[model samples]
Target chain A: MIEEREIHKEYEIKENPLVDVAAYLFLEDIADKQGAAGMNNYLISLATSLAKSMPEEEYKTWEDFVESLEKGESIISTFESVRAKTNHCMVTHKCPFERGWKEYTKRIGDFARVHKEVADYYNSTVKPGVNDTQCIICQTFRAAAAERITVAKKRLKYAQLAAVAPDGSKKIAPDEWKPILLEKAGVTNTDLNMVLRNNACIWILY
Target chain B: MLDVALVSLIQDMSEKAGVEGTIQYWERVGESLAMRMGKEAYMGWPSFNVALREGRTAYSIEGDVTPLTDLAVTDVDGDVVGYIYALKTCVFEPTMQRVRYSVGDVPQADAAVAEEYNNSVKDTAICNFCVIHQKFREEVAKNITVADQPLECVQLADRGFKGETKIARDSLKRIGINPEYVRSLLRNYACVFAILMKGARLKGEEEVEE
Candidate 1:
């Protein structure tokens, strides 16, 4: 028989809370007020603004810009940039938000319970569609993550032009850069859409 | 962590088959390893129980719960069920070292090496561990007898979320769970919940003499 003492002994350990409950509650409150879709939009916009906050002068080229993004300590770890055939460069990394959630789950206990609670709250309050099995919190987090990539791509495009022509005399239209970037990065529109929509690890950057 | 030869092989595969093909090849490697290791080494019930016991004790005392080894399992009641041990540090330490090394600023080959290594490799490694554990569960169905009742291990996390692409899809399908989420728990971790439940007989298994 499994002794109660053994079970109790095993159940005793706990870790220091990595994230403050108050912070989580605060986010939860905002999520509650905004509802699912609104909160998702809000998160994406926040990520966009955060990406834009990076100073452009620090980077000489698109590569420099991409390198700078990974300089600081973050919840996300393990970043790799793989250059495929042609001009396609794939920047892949583990999702930081997902890592944070795992740590948070370790501290709190039971991922399913937490997921269910959040899902229940959203389903009851927001009235999800019949086919919508998607978790609101996950959707919101993923949107924000995908937005970061999108904004970074835009910034990289500008940096690419600046690298080619430092002087203001040579003018390259922003619209033209989009196609040039697509060709240079060796990524098609479909690839970009898939990466964004799926929150894929690989980011197409030239 | 993979050996230098394996890493070179992966790189070579990437060159020949592209990123998607390389990832697929890696998945096959993991599956083969799992098969070779056998069921007990990869998915023994006792091993999982011990891991859970150790994890709970480690976490309760505010001890350092090493990733890929000490994983904390939780149940539907928001209670910590127990930890399921997966890989030792020795198993993936070299890989972590490679990640650290790759992160340094150095232009290598056509790609300018980024500051950090891609975590997909680590995630895939952990997923491979899960694949091994799942293989046993699928084949045997019931491999252990606890308190005179036969018990089967049920993984809380779906086994379909094995590779990076499938993991990405599962992240959306299962809400927030992804490869990173699994790897963060431990290097070689299994997120099993059913075996930790109370009263095995109540779950409808025959009570036999131990």
Candidate 2:
């Protein structure tokens, strides 16, 4: 616990109420655009945390905290759309393996932004002032499920290759085929087992 | 190379030959050859699994059908080396995309006929596998010193671990890797990781068990 405190002290927290409000507003915008209506509860919790952190002179009520957020300056940075970001990375990278990593990060970042945006909108707009706290749980679940499905799809392709030798045993070297699967799938042995254990027969046919 | 046009012709002919005709064709063609050649002798083998290591449409067949044309053996430069006989007793099934041919036959038979049949069977496997069958054939012809002996199932089964391992290995190799280190890593740490990860997930279940 002492270590944790020291670690925390090493990185001082930003205490600006407007900064907190700006973060929430950004999340609200993300939620609105990404069809993520499940982050409202988390957004509320975040708002509450910010409110608590606020000096007593800044605001006493939660409503006052939200109002302060609405008044904050709107700064739009150079954020690229998910599709554009992915395409740019895929086209520009010399190595396909590296490109795939960039593309995945960009996609995850975009989805995270979308989740925040949806949460903010729900908290500030729909059911405004309602204190229900289940929205955050649902958003987390949606994100988790989406990630699993994407991973499952990629792993399934590797399994398909294993079933059929690429060069046709008479044709290609069987030894060569195995390495190709790893390179293309971006999977290590550890990842492959996780995929196989999680997926198995279901991944192939289904 | 078997002409795609010829395959279309045979398929059209066989379909017109009707269901009974198809069966009779197999029985007379596929079965008779299987009987006459006594599968072991290679005259009448019905089917055999051709081996492939990597790529799409890996496994294929030999003597799966009769050739529609004669074959003239040639080198990579198209120079004639030796001629292989072609036979018509083998039937081609385009729908199945298989060449029903004999694995072995009487040596005295026309080399041109045997060559055609070999070509047809090959074309069928290629079509079925939806791969460039020639490339596979060339690779096999080069790597496989003996086409006369088919790959035994026992041998294939011994290599079964390869199904999963190869996929992992191939993916790594594409980046110019010798994944022996990865295998060593897997051997050293994979099970430990699996248990640790699973223990975390099943922590609640285990608590209930406790």
Candidate 3:
């Protein structure tokens, strides 16, 4: 009754750090490549949504990640400095995303070093031309990202095109729509803000 | 006439970007935009100074034909120098996607697709030469050179480029080459014999060689 794609996919992901890393890369690739990276909060939500879909039994948590380091099982465990501080972040305060997913989590001291390997591990899902295990998953993620980007673009366009404020309290001139459109598009970071600013540029010659 | 401001921009960007590569890229981008807007649309730019119109027109004409393979011009002070390849091959585009393949380049419509295109009423070709046609840019890069100019951004637009196509078209009508041979060549190779041999040659015009 179920399709082949549905069989291997876990509906509710466990609090495994390994799985979380994979989901992070997947979320980033979809959003960044498809022009949805501007929606920072939306991207975090999408990652959470995707992370919430896998089975916990198959993955490891932040505590487990630290344990793996001590045991020298994972590539990430080799760094003693980063592993030294993991317990405190795990015991005292959970990172924002991890707050809901788990009761306890460890903070990565050398996040940059850890992320490089995490990215590599995530990319290991494919062997280029030979085998692509994540092809279907990537397609699905891109489709989702495209939908989000389309909605965001349209919402911004509507804000620009609207003659009056949403509350009907004030009328907006066509020339004044640029700033409002940027705000509506959620241009928080430098990159997305640049994209928004570029849309308003028009060269006048003479 | 020259475009002083544009040259300044390109030169400035190139220096800041730390490479001549970037400036060349920007010029190519400008050329592509001009080609897309076309001569009519470019002249319609209301803010452009009346004095600069002639220079703009010349740039537009060059964008239309030169480097049919890519940005065919070099950005000068305020002017652009372009070269239209003076090939004698008939360049036919029965389909927009398959236009890169020159089947009738041999003074006759020899490619099967060419024959089918010439005879059929359908806009799309029965045989899609897209795969082979796609490689034309890279091959052109590897092969063709006019003076020392290199095409930076090769592309085919919706509006067909009529280069040396007329001569080749006339040649096809004059000689009676088989459509099957043309099609086989197109299917097997990206270009016809004549086009591959001395393709996209831009020199002073002369009588048709073949």
Candidate 4:
């Protein structure tokens, strides 16, 4: 019964920091990667309200509690600094998201420091080629490249489209498609030609 | 991006609570947001940004992506440069408590009822304590910079700064915070904390190749 009560209490209308952190992280991720404004708004509102409910004992006032929330941004900024050392931001000009969960959170400096030991162990004991050593630079580069690929895929959505002719002639194929598709699909629609008229037509000398 | 201390604290707490799984859950949510937002927003890890360069239509930054927690493009000329979109969550309802001692018409002693009440009290105490942490986490996520830098009056004054802490400290003093604490804060928070989180992501990439 105590266990049940505890479980129920946890599930009940009470603030669970774990849940809060999870929710905050969730919405922030949404706000950042997905631009889910609504979800972000919901998470932010919950977080703000929870912050407001702090017992005055833990903080001098609601304002002080709210201020700590401000510190979260600072924490984020610090992470950026850490990411910077790895060139995760500048080279990518963005947050590194092309990586798996592990790649994003694994501190590269730490990885490099520890990886060599593991690599050495494998190299000294394992068979050649079987004990392939992992290099930090390669890992970091791989992560960056992966992130680049992801970015490229996202950017490709806005890529300009062009038409190529099989016979190298200026011709709107029976390939003329729907206007909406045409408008949304290719290079500027103004670039398209309605007809292939020639000046060879008989003209009155004016 | 997140401050090392805060991340350490959160990481510690998460470990204590056996909630590392939560990180993956949030990451999934972040990924989902990235997919959905598409070109409307930049879906950098740990944060998001709204700026889009001309002729570029993607959520991924072509160059180094600023963490959502940084204010790089948001603050210019010692003033917040751009609009900040905010999101948050609401508090859930509290648990209920039952009072009584009537079972099979056998009157229970007040001592037994007092024990139950005491346990309830203890449970509520624990619940309150847990709530504080939850609240803290939620608030922390709100108003985070595109990078993970904390928003302070001093930092606010140096929004678009491109110099060392010395320049920032002087600027903060000009804005009214004591020069001493400003320097201290800059050293502790800016140098150590923000350095790791807000530091440029792409600057040293070329050097690493060597």
Best by the TM-score measure = 1
DockQ of each candidate relative to the true complex? 0.02, 0.00, 0.02, 0.05
Q: So what's the TM-score on candidate 3? A: 0.18
**What's the TM-score of every candidate structure?**
0.28, 0.15, 0.18, 0.17
- Regions of candidate 3 where Cα sits further than 4 Å from its true position: A1-34, A37-206, B1-205, B208-210
Over B1-210, each residue of candidate 2 has an lDDT whose tens digit, in order, gives 011112222333344654334323322332221222122212111221111111111111322222111322233344322222111111122211211111112112122222333354321111211112222233333222222433211000001111122113332322222346444433322110000110121222333446
Least accurate 10 contiguous residues by lDDT in model 2 chain B: B153-162
Candidate 2 C-alpha error for residue A46, in Å: 20
Predicted structure with the largest lDDT when compared to the true one: 1
| C-alpha lDDT of candidate 4 relative to the true structure | 0.25
Report the poorest 10 consecutive residues by lDDT, candidate 3 chain B. Answer: B1-10
Residue A17 Cα positional deviation in candidate 1, in Å, after optimal superposition = 6.0
What candidate 1 gets wrong by more than 4 Å, as runs, is A1-17, A20-26, A52-54, A62-88, A105-184, A187-200, B1-210
Docking class of 2: incorrect
TM-score of chain A of 2: 0.20
Better of 1 and 3 by TM-score: 1
Return the lDDT, model 1, position B33: 27
Q: Please, what are the lDDT tens digits per residue for candidate 4 over residues B46-163?
A: 2333342221322221122223243222221333322211112111111111011100111122123223322532221111112222223223333234333432211211110122
Quantify all predictions' global Cα lDDT against the true fold: 0.32, 0.25, 0.25, 0.25
Docking class of 3: incorrect
